[model samples]
Target: MTARTDQAEITALVDRFFLALDTREFTPGWARAYLTDDARMDAPVGAKRGAEAVRTAETALLRFARTQHFASGVVTDAAFGTDDATASWNAYMVHVHHSPAADPLFVVGGRWEATLRRTPEGWRFSAMTVHVVWTRGEPPTAEPG
Candidate 1:
């Protein structure tokens, strides 16, 4: 594939992850579209491995009434020659708590780094990590410990 095509695919994979979470999509094997079978994921709520990462993600998401995520400035260090690559981007997310809570919103901004490997299915994350740069509003009262 051409560089632009590779870049586009990598960027789309990154964007698709946020979209899937915002939509709360848990269709069977959906997580595999984004993560490898042995992926390591570390986020605010917890750390998870492989497809199990979706469980931690969904649990954290259920605490919020709604959630929105935006990813931008994606930069990829393409090593498609080796069928692997690394990418980083900035993210801004807003989580709205269930009504009746005193503080109903939690906002967080962070930088995310991901290692991707190309499998027969497509590009999937082998490892992902996020570094919190800032946050506003209070998080959900019932976050998993």
Candidate 2:
């Protein structure tokens, strides 16, 4: 595939990933769609490696509360290497929850850096790192019409 096509595919994959999480669909099949077998994820809890580990971590996270990851204003930089590529993007996220029952929580905009490898399964994320800019909690308010 051409570079543009590859980049587009990756972008779609990233979007789907966040969408699935926001909808609380933590199925292994869905989680594996974008991550490689050896992928690793790092969060406040800790680091997890491998597809199964990633799935487990995600499931636990979703159980915390109802969440939505709004990935707005994505800026991607794709670097084509000999056999693989790396792409990074910054996104603005609003993570809502019902724990406090006060206001929806917002995770300030953050950056996502991923290393993708061209594989038989198509472009897959071999490594992903999420850098959070800030976090704040707001009292729950009526949903906007």
Candidate 3:
């Protein structure tokens, strides 16, 4: 494939990665479909390896009632000799939780750095790292019984 084509594929793959996070649900199928078998993810929380580990890490977002991930300003730097593609993007994340007293919202600003590779199925994330630059507001809380 041409360079432009490869870039497009990588962009689309990144888009899907964000979309999966926006879903607010971390299903096993989603991981199987989106991430390569040996994918690794690093974030402020910790690091995880493989698809199952990635799923577990992402699912932690479920602590919030609702979640959304906005990925923008994507810039990809690719090495010509290798099939690997690396990209950086600005991320705006919102998390909402409802309590009997009031609803809490958390807004987070961060950057996503990901390395993708072409697989038999398509382009998949081989590694991803998130750097949380800043955060504001409070996360959601469960209702007290």
Which 10-residue span in candidate 2 carries the lowest summed lDDT? 136-145
What is candidate 3's local distance difference test score? 0.76
Predicted candidate 2 versus true structure: per-residue lDDT over 1-145, tens digit per residue: 6677776887887888788776776654665677788988775445788865676566545544656666554444555565577777777666556456555464556787888777777778888778877667652343322
> Which residue pairs in candidate 3 collide?
none
Give one digit per residue, the lDDT tens place, for model 1 in 1-145. Answer: 6667767888999999999999997888888888998999898777899767878878888888889999999988777467788999999999997865667789999999999988997788899998999999987766543
Candidates arranged by lDDT, highest first: 1, 3, 2
TM-score of each: 0.92, 0.77, 0.84
Instruction: Give the true-structure RMSD of model 2.
Output: 5.4
Clash number for candidate 2 = 5
Between prediction 1 and prediction 3, the one with superior TM-score is 1
| Top candidate by lDDT | 1
Predictions in order: lDDT = 0.87, 0.67, 0.76
- Error (Å) of candidate 3 at residue 87 is 0.8
